[model samples]
Target: MPFKPSRRHLHTATYVDNKLYILSGFDDSIGIKGIAGIAGKQFFYLDVSVPFNTQEILWHDLTNINLVPSHIGAGSVKGGTNNNTIVLCGGRYLANAENKASVYTFDTRSNSWSIPTIIGESYIRRRRDLTAIINDDGKIYLFGGSLIGYNIVVNDMLILDTINLSWGKSSTLNAPIPRVYYGADLLPNQTIIYIGGETFVNQSLTLNEVYMYDTINDNWSTKKTSGSIPSNRAGLSAVLGLDGQRVIIFGGYRNNRIISAQDSLYTLNINTFEWTIPKIFGNIPGPRCLHKANLIGNYMVISFGMGYQQSESDILLLDISNNDEYKWVINFNPPISSSSPTSPTSPSSPTQIFAQKSAAAIIGIVIGSLISSILLTVGIFFLYKWTKNRRIQKNETSTSDNYNLQRTSVITATNNYNQSSQGVISTTLTNNKVYNHGRENEEIMKIHDNEDNPINDENIISEVTEIKNHGQESISVNNNQSSSIQNINNINNIDNNVVQYLKDEMIQVVRQEVNQLINSDNSNNNY
Candidate 1:
């Protein structure tokens, strides 16, 4: 609800105690010559719980703290003993330097950052744009990200025990290929689900495979998911629903010939491994990549990112209290093309209309049958009760089953009012077995990989603010290199390809819907 942070991408935002904190990132507006400047030292936060229109929402800047120059692809998490601290992991500094394997923690209570500590063995290279997740045990898991300067992507898994303050490598068999800029989320089962990310083999390749890692067994397995899979893209935001049964995936950039951002929303049912695109109502945010999404209560908050036409500062909220449908709302509407089709709108084509009708008919039939069964059962129950009362008073006897039922009812009545009144339906059903926290912790690990440019040959400093002026100068040198310029060109070409790919996918989806509608119509005519 506060004034949005400066326009940037590759930044991380986490919600803690109803407050949102945004870390350093890249701001294209501060480019040196023709190269973009990385805003690593800037930090800001807002009290998200404040009503939007009541008070003037203002961003509180805390950029004066000494911080490492790690902007792009940095991994961050908020989970300490108090759950008030934020931990930032590996990332690059500048173009000439290597990726950092350092770790830093920010204490909200003290309003200070801990000294940077190098993580892992000397042989382990620093990485950026990696994903990180913290389990109930407070251990952070680091996953795939790229090495600085080199095109190498590391697939090795690393674990940082926050309690002991030590790093250990996870020996996982059959891990996914090394990647960067991928989307990841921790499931209720304690397993981590990794989605799309890009890797460099001979050249840059985007991946679509789903990789699942079992923290308990320290093993990896590829899941065969059904339904319409989304196109391969990097920097997508994935968040586990409050119920932890479903995961919501939002916008990301598809690197092809041209960089194109996606605006669609997809959901994955963890139990069934089925992906579905639900119709969202309200104002939808435009296509963007490198944004952050966090699950707070029943709302999925989408923060800053780079849009298709420009950078964005708006926040989008996707309400997931109801799995049957979704509602999208944004904090503010930034100026974009009026012709853009990213706004939330119902599917209105003939095919979509027919599908809706068919679904409604099926639901109506099921409801009618349920009501009929309930009425019949009630009638029989009343008749039996009357008959029993008429003749069973002398023969009536106390039974253990009846006593148990009475006890259960008494217990339910006593505890019902104590349950959470957040208006959200509990994902865990009454019939489901409750799991202990220790067992859930043993089931999963969190892994993160991100990318950042390392600063030239300078000693990694205790005072990170000293290198703030060096960022622009380093970008100027990077811009002069022939190879660097060529790489930039290649990235632009990939973006073009992304746009074309999105267009083709849209056309294909429309065609498939039409065919399904035609088939349904034919079947009805035959009947």
Candidate 2:
């Protein structure tokens, strides 16, 4: 077949699976029903192949992988998780509904097309003329695009999970005000960076601010830009370079107030959040926006955007190596096939002795497994012992539902409960005596009136029971005062008397548990 004049506009093309896949765009010839004059359900693929023994490059049209026709929007082309599926999300296109939100996927392996069954997108008509970016993990994001009959762009962001065919909205706050024809990129840490889009106004102006979206944290942060900033221009192109660590932005428009091409390039260190204008080495491509950029090896293949008089710019190469060496190299060579051995070697030859010994090394794996099992058994035994003791300690902890009685010193330091509520009185307890506000010389007092009334130590038990009937609500009123009295006494009393009682009880319980464990271990050892 000779060169056919079947052409299209406002379409999307992506370089994937060693070939370029083309999808829906504006097609006036194919009109049907309400979708007449619209590029819907019309698409094709071109395979970049070099015929055997040929020196020329040829694009073979593959009829099997045609997709629905759709218009090209800002940052819509993206690759999937395995780099095997190319996902084309929201882009502006004229349809029966003027512009429709239609999504489709192209399978590289089978050269087939399918409208991915995505969740939460059934009612969404279209997300036309939007800025989008694909993160490192292959999640395609669409943000800030104009819908049907709307001159203003939207601030909503949607995420399409390519791996699972699920669509969800990300929580991004303080997003850049909605605009169209913007530049977008994904940083190394998966933060989506957006810049420079024209807003809807009588005198439409381009944005100078830069906004970043942290996909992992679902938060947005704005960077305060300083120094020489690029001219406010829309339709600029940006691509992530150096393993997504660096972002390179090129072309858009400037002070002319008209859509013009620009050669100025800017580099942003995604890690440091810094921008730098680097010097170009050789011939650089003239500034152009609404263009597409694809990273092939170390070079970026940039092409296809409106230019002055020249509507479609020729494909240019931006070399992102050490220096800003830019050139326009478009010829793509076919990948070479791997060479196979001419003759088969015998397995029993003397040269194969090393291979036989390597096979025999599998026995070492059995020995390693046995040793691992022994170590695991020992580890589990210790873990079980530790867990059992922890459980016993947790069970023995005192569980009291009673309110504690406040001592007289605690009540006085708190100034009859006035200071207690206001938080003016802070205290600590040492040897049952209160120390108030870092001061010394506070006296200890008996909580109950035992000596004055002929109430003996036996009465102490009854008074304690009565206080225990009160709840924590009453205790909250006195806790601050009680804490202050705790530090009044010396350290020896806390360490000797109070500690000795608990230590003796704990030692006896541990001894009994250890004896039982030892007996069990002995029984197992004998078995």
TM-scores for all candidates: the values are 0.58, 0.55
Candidate 1 per-residue lDDT, tens place, 310-403, comes to: 4323566677778888887544222222222122223487766765576455334433433454344445434543553343232222222344
For model 2, residues 1-527, the per-residue Cα lDDT tens digits are 63221334334557665555545554434532115545534444434333221122233455444544445452345475456676777665554443243666666666676776777777564666665677766677888777755555678888877777678887747877777767787776778888777665522334345888998888888876554566677766677875567777776654334343333577766666566776655544455545556665556656444442232233455566554434444444333441211111224755356434532442233234333543443354346435644543342231111122234556666667555443332222111221123224322112233344222222222100000111212212244434322322232343234334543443344334434543543444345
Q: How far is candidate 1 from the true structure (C-alpha RMSD, Å)?
A: 38.8
> Which portions of model 2 miss their true places by more than 4 Å?
1-10, 24-57, 62-67, 70-81, 97-101, 123-125, 136-138, 202-208, 254-262, 308-313, 323-527
Worst 10 residues of 1 by lDDT: 460-469
Q: Pick the candidate with the highest lDDT.
A: 1
Q: Candidate 2, which ten residues in sequence have the lowest lDDT sum? A: 461-470
Report the C-alpha displacement of residue 417, candidate 2, in angstroms. 99
